[model samples]
Target chain A: MRLEPIANPGLARSAGLPAAAIALTVVVASLLALLAGADPLATLGLILKGAAGSKFALLETLNRATPLIFTGLAVAVAFRAKLWNIGAEAQLYAGALLTVLVGTQLGLPGPVALPLMALAAILAGALTLLGPVLLKTRLGVDEVVTTLLLNFIMLLFISMLLEGPLKDPLGMGWPKSEALPRDARLPRIVDGLRLHWGFGLALICALGTWVIQTRTTLGYEIRATGLNLQGARFAGIPVNAVMVKTALISGGLAALAGFSEVAGLKGNLTLDISPGFGYTGIIVAMLAMLNPLGVVVSAIFVAGIFVGADSMSRAAEVPTYIADILLATALLFMVLAIMLTRFRVVRG
Target chain B: MDLIDILLSASFWAAVIRIASPLIFATMGELICERAGVLNLGIEGIMVAGAFAGWVAVYAGLPLWWGVAVAMLVGMAFGLVHGVLTVPFGLSQHVVGLGITMLATAAAYYAYRIALPEVTTPPRIEPFQPLDMGWLTDIPVVGQALFGQTALTYLALLVALATGLVLYRTPLGLALRAAGENPSAVEAQGLSVTGIRIGAVVVGSGLMAVGGAFLTMSAFSSFFFEMVNGRGWICIALVVFGAWAPGKAVLGALLFAGFDALQIRLQQTGLGAVVPYQVFLMVPYILSILALVLMSRRAEVPAALMTPYNRGER
Candidate 1:
């Protein structure tokens, strides 16, 4: 008997695969939990309970999920167009820097300043990818290398900014920029909870992304370009333009992640603010099967896992990194399941 | 002190070579792997896993060489996972490679927690001693830098030389290159492209692991979280800068290490106060990007670089 990938699968089969993959992830993670001397069932229950068992916990989960929604949507759009924008991490930082500078310097009222901050963030994020995209289009430079390299460079630039010009005088030797004034802060959605209008903004972005991908001519061109670059070019799809547009949109979305963190959560920019939220977006996008609407679900699920893991570590004495293991394993299984959609497994 | 004083110092040169050793080992491996058609983004995690494994070995009272062996084995095992998914399943290389990195990195972190839970200061082991070649180490700037270095530094040079011989001078190397450029063509010639690619990945990852181990076993003597610190990614860039050649890759690693050493020295000498030290830290990454842009147009990348092969399919 031999196994091979099946061609031309239907939607039902595709839908079933991710469910099976999540089940597989649960099993593998259980084995890990067992090895770590914890009861798998209890650990799983604790995780779910920690993330959504109470109103406060659920609020925290959604708060944690807000940035991921933006980042995940960013990744989904880029991957859909076959543009590997690994610089989301850098782009996010770029957005944050721009947002901070604009918000702090402009000193406009809330109505005027918030919109300006968002625009600066989105534009700065998109602009960061311009050099890499242009290089890829013009000279055949690999975007993966350039984008990944930019992440390091942008991070150092952020460090330079914080320690040099941006450092707050009253900050007492901490490496952080000055906090945004009340007019610049995101209006909190729920009083006493960390949830803010950024949560609403994330949902809107996700819905907007879904509409763009499904209903727009640009979406069709992007889909065609990703499916077959040569064929798209042959069909007069303007493949390069599609790639550049996708990069811009993806980079802009990633910047929103940065914006949310600074405006809603942190209130001031620090070197340690992100904690690799941008990179986690790639996993979320993949787990969502690169679908825009699904990005919301996956982002929330991932954020829940992370938040729950921290709680589990404190309450159950489980290692915090156990969450990382489960997430990584889930990522692998999800991809394997997704790829399985391309080919049916048949035994001969 | 002026620029000449720093440039002329034996210790500065020594610092460059010492700092570059890990990159040299990793770049050779990365060059070989890429030449064989698989882009292993798992390099970062593999290096971290290697560092952890080596540290554990030394902590367990094993010799330094034993620790290196264990680290290489861990790397090869991770490579095997990458090979199985990408080679046979025909999965996307980028996703699978990234997944493997995440898995390995998580595993390394978990292992570290289990082994040394909640230590305020990280544990240290006996690091490899410098092999001072008496008369050889006395020659101005080149002497102490080249001759009075750790044995692993010397081994890194040997690995580079051996990689060159294996890649350019051997028939197996030709088959490996052929497998990357055109796997179907290699299969047509009755060589198992799968076998060649898998072997190359396993060996290449093993070498990368050794590079990681060198950081813990020789350079620092302690395994801290994120000690690899994007060195593996830098090695990936260096491979592009080197145009996939082992010899040129050596130069790339040295250039990166030179910047790193210079920055550390400048910071120590209070000269870095004029500009934020981050400016110097940014130099290596920025230079690599510039190198990528300049050389990429002419780079002869293997044709089938990121594609998974399925028999009877185009």
Candidate 2:
């Protein structure tokens, strides 16, 4: 059997498949809602209304999606370079720790402190990810395994800090860091809402990623390397260096997610902040077909589903995990839809 | 307590065996799958599914052994899902694997919550108890630790050794290995590489389910949301650390289990206060990374790993 993509699978037709997949996912999710004893149409209406029905919902949705954009971009960068950096979650934690540790200790003005926190977070994410990168590049260690395991190690490392030295002495015994001072917390973009300046940073990061991926030498090397590692090596492209740099950038991007959450929203570190954004980012990257710009749109879509589902659960008897089912179903359909676009399957 | 006091105690060795049991099964399962070139990153999710399925079955008044069967069957079904997606479609292995993990885990958690609405005070059943070793349990320091273990623990040891033998000594194993190493060669020899690879994946998934069953049926004997945690990931690492050899994989699992058991003891002994217990928990994961670095130089990856076997395509 062989697959030959029909010559120039028309742009519209190519685009049509993903749209069809979205429909398929919605139908499946509706059936699931029906099983949970809810009217599918009503459930869908509830989700839509809860997601963006009002002014407050819009801000909340964007705020929720802010971290996802960073993590999704993190996953996109590494995946596009054919580097599997599954440690993004841990790298996010590393950034969170640095945001608190550096902010409290340095005591710089807001402008200097914010940039310093961002830089420290980026460096922290990159350096923390260096272990897996070296093992992967130098020794051929499976990054999937190493990076994944490093998440566990990172979780333990951060938990140690949060519970031991960094524990807030006055937060009634909860294991979280002291709140960031006014100088350190990210400035708010709106009054009476949690929206913060990190939203702007996230937008800029997405734009920067788009420009880099589509219009630069490094981007060319990365895309080429992802397309064909052997060919890239043969073409005198530094595949190893590209992989390392992508890994660093990927880690930095993920770290910024932590920075956004802590500095922009929480103003303190806690274990409950991220709900698997690092892992979900993979789905976002795949949904966008690894396009940097598409990541922003997909990230927001995922966030909307989750946040809406939370409100839906509060309003109805349905559980919130139904969103997980919807998301996973959508991903499977997306992959199948993509494969269909790329290949004309023949009987084996 | 001192290092000797920790290592020499019967409780220490028992904890090691108890902890190593689930990993031994998972690592051996991974060894076979990787050897056959399937690279089922879905193993983690499948194990979680198995744990939930087994627990639900036993809770519903089925025989304990029946629950084990339920686990294996559920795992095989997922193995089929993974095989169809990766083997035929040639989708990204990591993407499919990660997606399966998320879906299966979420489904399991949902089922647990929905099935048992009394989440505040959950029901419990009597889990399998350790076997009686009689005189064997009476032996000085090693007696209780080595002999007084659950039946699953001993089965895990036997499975590890059996896997090593089957991998090295059997004809089917040869076909599986050949399929992974050079599928084109195997296909030319009038053999179905795809069939062998799919068979490998299904069988590996079944064993992994049993490993999951061990967690619910023997280790903790209760289903928790995050029970499997990262053990599946650890098993993946153990396979690499042991260079894809089942016997060595068992040893690697034991090493990790020993570290895990030791940390618990050190923590309880108040030494954990000196260094936060969370830091001590990092020891096993960190040590495994070091082991991977040391072992990767001699690692023997299957040539066709993560590659779909497209029939008649160069």
Candidate 3:
């Protein structure tokens, strides 16, 4: 079998293939449930019900998706420029560390403190990624391995800080940071709602990212650079400058995930603030095909699976790791499906 | 003890060799894949799966060697999936690799939970014992460091030597290297590039699994979550550090493991009290980055690495 390029794929093929990918993921998930001796249909139902069956569940998912949206957007932006920033986890931690530092140390008013915390977080994250990006641009190193290695390095740095200078004085022997001041905490979206303003910020950022990608000069440059670096260079585009700019934006966006998690949901920063949100962002970005608005939708979908699976595990014998397996399957299948949309498989 | 005294101790050298064993296996594995023009980022998860597969197989009464075989087969299965997507499908290697890692890791964890539901602590098995070299073991620090190790450690060193010999001496090695450097040339010779690439990935990934098995079967007696840690990623760095050569990669692995051994020992010294334990833990990762930066200017990466080759495209 060989693949032949399609001249133009219709809307049905484009839409149907991704839908079928999701369907395939569901089928795989069902097989896993069967392996565990649980009823597949009931297990899936439990997941969906636990994810959005009630107001609390929906709010929980929204809160979880909040960080995902930030990280997903981060990955989407970096990948669009072909920068290959796998250190979103490190960037997120950078943001979280700054948030904790400023939120706890500074005694400014809410209006002054909140924005300052975010700015510091963004700067920290952007700088965290800038190191690897510079290494790539100057030394001709591959960003993928450098970025990945930085994640481990960043976590160790965080651990050191937590155990040393940043340790909470009030907490008994636990390695955690001090809680953010009440004024620094993000207010709920609605007075009675459990959701924080981070979700609202995520939506705004997604819309803003979409606008930037579709209606800006920088976006076009990024796309061109990604498509053909030598061609873009021949066309007079500053390729290295574009990469640096993309890194700053991507790092800043990922850092926001850490900020929101600390200042919005969790009051204090800990080593486990992110349960692989940075890594999961790659899945979200790939599933969205690097589309910013699609990242929002995909982040919510991914978060729902995690939240749902967590709740479902309590009720059924199936482990929550099923969520990871399902998403991974979806990501692989979706990429293949997307490819099939533009290429037709033919028997030679 | 002081630094000189610590370096002179037989125990320190033994730890260095022991730590280097798994890394040598995984580095050689990664070296093969990169040499064949495929970057198998699934190394970490593949290692995890191998650790679990090998340990569980032994726990279930399989012979230790059979357990290693089971781990290799499991690694190859994941490798096949990765090879299919990245090769024939022409998908992004980065995306497919990370996807494979996530899938493999989750599947391993899920299977473990299902297999042992009630155990809080991971169960242990009788791991490989050190071979007795009689008087060879009596020869100062060098003796224990080189000869007083499990069969797997010797196998790791042998694998590294074999990799170097095969890559430099064999016809198959020439074709494999050509696949990475110039696949069109390989195709011109009436060889199927796809088959060669897929085979390299399969075999390379099998070696990576054995590296992981070395953890459970030799280094430790039990399998646990996150046992592979970031060792797989470190091996990728080692490949670059070694400039994609098997002998140099083995040296890189030894250098890295030496740093690791020193850090562990340093933690017990007076310096350990002055510095945070996390600082010592950070040394290997930092060294990896430094190694990359230092080698970046000199290293000759496979010309066609990460590039998907489509017949008749040009």
Candidate 4:
């Protein structure tokens, strides 16, 4: 009998691959820019200027990054616990719809109304998560399928609201909800700044997520179960409970993002309230290598791409879809590069 | 309400077939892919791609069938890319799947703007003609309901039965099932996991493209941006509702289609004018969630689904 022994030198390989992935994404994206008939160097400059060159630009970037922060954290949290919840977009809509119902229909005072709306958002989001969670836990349904399916339902619900019940009667037939009252809106963090208190909330949430992920007992159990559910079960962890708990927390965080978008940026509910922020969060979380602090940087980077892409569209006459292609291409490049961390590549 | 009278009408049946056509096509494709363990998330993108390509081909003066052929070819090409990326390149399934979606969406949007710049009414071909069975039309309810659907509707039902038989009673089906359930185990037994997956991807995406073509050739004679409108995702759910089988998925599609038809009917009725339109419009999605919640007990996910396979590794 011939035995082939496994030679596992792991730490060195893992340590080197993440940086390699980032570099690969940049290089591949530069090549793609050439194909799109734009100079990569010039495009990068425009992106920088658009994202951070001026106070206004930087403010916009941060404003855009705010919801991404919460959603990136949401995806990262559920992913860390080994659940694939692809329904964040739907959860965001659920949150937004609930916030509208609470904030607009009830007609309460500002301070009290805002908190009530936030609570409603969180509750709606968490409730939406319960179906997938319970189906996975009790009925052996795959959460991936259940959650992905729910996304359509949520979007359709939004369409229903916007096109019918929630349409602003004052807007002359626009498919949008009534705008929140002046008191219901969040104050800008500074004069002439697009930044709102949502940015602060995002920052605080990031810090809170970092601490919860690293310092708490729940984190330990969640992390252990993520590594191997059966092993965690053997180690006396209640795996199913952890999965459900983490999923609800994730959904709640994502919903909070919806609140931020509605209350912080857009006062009125619109069909396109999310410019795919929830979906973008998936790539951001994965690119961050699932680190809480890393998610902040990755979110900012993604926000820059979105912000800069518009400038490039204006300046170079390049379509914004080019930027979309670049962003998606870079994500694929990153995923491919990351695969090298676990598996060695050989030409043989 | 006169909802029952509206439901009993011939137009209501036409609406049901129209709504169900794309879903039947998509769910069938998803059924094949899931059976083989690939879980083609690219169906959303592929459907969008097909919608664009089919419309473009039609606008370019090609026959509708030719447009469909080109769409299927394009879908197959996309499947090839998806298969190679995950199976050979060993990328994350979800990541590659998402990439395909984004790529297809961007491509469709770009192409739509380029091709249909001035056409406000949208570029349309003559839609597929409804097939009226001569004798079957004599039966009041069943005839109007089942016998007067377009060719694609009947074709969708045929695809369902054919897929069902193939999936359950063929050697290829057995091999694909083995690949999905336990690739490494299958590979140990001298099967080609990559080959099986690639084959599944091609066939599945091709089916999804037909679903897309159904959108143009039967439901509407034109294509628009994001026109699949989350139906691909709905098909993904339908796969679950069908227990990853073809026959049940068609049933699920028809069930949802019935609700959609009723919703449209309600939208046209006097009662609909009195009530909020949102409640009527939300019927399909709300029904989808209800279906999910109700059928949560019957989920039987494939064991090896979504897991990237390695050649002979533990």
Cα error, residue A45 of model 3, in Å, equals 0.8
Better candidate by lDDT, 1 or 3: 3
Docking class of 2: medium
* Cand 2, B chain, TM: 0.96
> Which structure is stronger by TM-score: 3 or 4?
3
Task: Give the per-residue Cα lDDT of candidate 1 at B3.
Answer: 62
Each candidate structure's TM-score, on Cα atoms with residue i matched to residue i, is: 0.96, 0.96, 0.99, 0.89
Best by lDDT: 3
Computed on C-alphas against the true complex, the DockQ of each candidate is 0.64, 0.67, 0.81, 0.40
User: A39 in model 4: Cα distance from truth in Å?
Assistant: 6.0
Q: For model 4, how big is the iRMS in angstroms? A: 4.8
- Which pairs of residues have clashing backbones in candidate 1? A5-A343, A6-A343, A6-A344
By TM-score, the best candidate is: 3
Candidate 2 pairs with clashing backbones: none
Residue pairs with clashing backbones, model 3: none
What does candidate 3's lDDT look like per residue over B274-300, in tens digits?
999999998998999999999999999
Fnat across every predicted model, in order:
0.66, 0.66, 0.78, 0.55
Chain B TM-scores per candidate, in order, are: 0.97, 0.96, 0.99, 0.94
DockQ of candidate 1 is: 0.64
* C-alpha root-mean-square deviation, candidate 3: 1.0
TM-score of chain A of each: 0.95, 0.97, 0.98, 0.92
Q: For residues B1-314, what per-residue lDDT tens digits would candidate 1 score against the true structure?
A: 75667788899999999999999999988888889898988888899899989889989999889999999999999998888777766677777777777788889888787777678798899999999788998998899998899888999999999999988899999999988899989989988877888888899889889999999999998988878878888898899889888989999889878877887788756677677788878877888888888888888888989887776667
CAPRI grade, predicted model 4: acceptable
